[model samples]
Target: MTFRKLMIAGAAVALLAVGATAAMAQTSAQKALIDAAKSQGTVGEQADGYVGVRTNADAELRAAVDATNNGRRAVYARSATEAGTTTEIAAARMFETQLLARVSSGQWYRNAAGQWVQR
Candidate 1:
């Protein structure tokens, strides 16, 4: 990545970690839903810092993901505004630069090319 991209990615990661302190907490059930989806390779984290369902999901699963992504977006938007960057930039940097590296095996993720990948 270019220098500017690297800087933005670093800022995004830092902001995410810091912002987690004030963000809405996820319920245990919601955490379980995400865990199951990751284990099942049905839902994955996208490069834009949102959750993506790679396959058909029941209503409950979809709802859970939607809620999670909405919360995440709110955090990203706040961070982006504070940093004087667009929300998409913050989100792209957050997930692509940090979250992707932490995804465990058997989980799905969207690559930089926007392809769904198993890692």
Candidate 2:
């Protein structure tokens, strides 16, 4: 792999390790809501390292998305600072490596081009 690819891969592995701990920061209820929304195709991972609502979202779903994105922003900010990179780059990397890879079959995710596609 190219040096850039290698760096990203390494960072991805690091992020994955960090993710397990970070996930514990979220409540079980929050994770359940997001997972349910994802499974139902109402919410999806976005290229910006945030969750997007793909269809009409109820108040509860919207709140859950907002909470999840807020947590993601904090993680990306910390990761960027540690890596000496911008938050956007850190988030994009996480999206490419972590979020995309986590998408279950038949779930939806928004691509870098802002298009929603099902896996």
Instruction: Give a tens-digit lDDT track for model 2, residues 24-104.
Output: 787788899999999999999999888999999999889888887777777777776666667788889999877899999
lDDT at 12 for candidate 1? 79
Q: Which lDDT value does model 1 have at 28? A: 66
lDDT of 2 at 76: 76
Error of 1 at 41 (Å): 0.5
Model 1 TM-score relative to the real fold: 0.85
State the displacement of the C-alpha of residue 90, model 1, in Å, after optimal TM-score superposition. 0.1
How displaced is residue 95 in candidate 2, in Å? Answer: 1.1
Report the Cα lDDT for residue 77, model 2.
73
Off by over 4 Å in 1: 1-10, 22-24
Model 2: which ten-residue window has the lowest total lDDT?
4-13
The candidate 1 region of ten consecutive residues with least summed lDDT is 18-27
lDDT string for model 1 (1-119, tens) is 97766667667767767657524466668769987988899899998888899999999898889888877877788777766788898888888666788789888998778899888
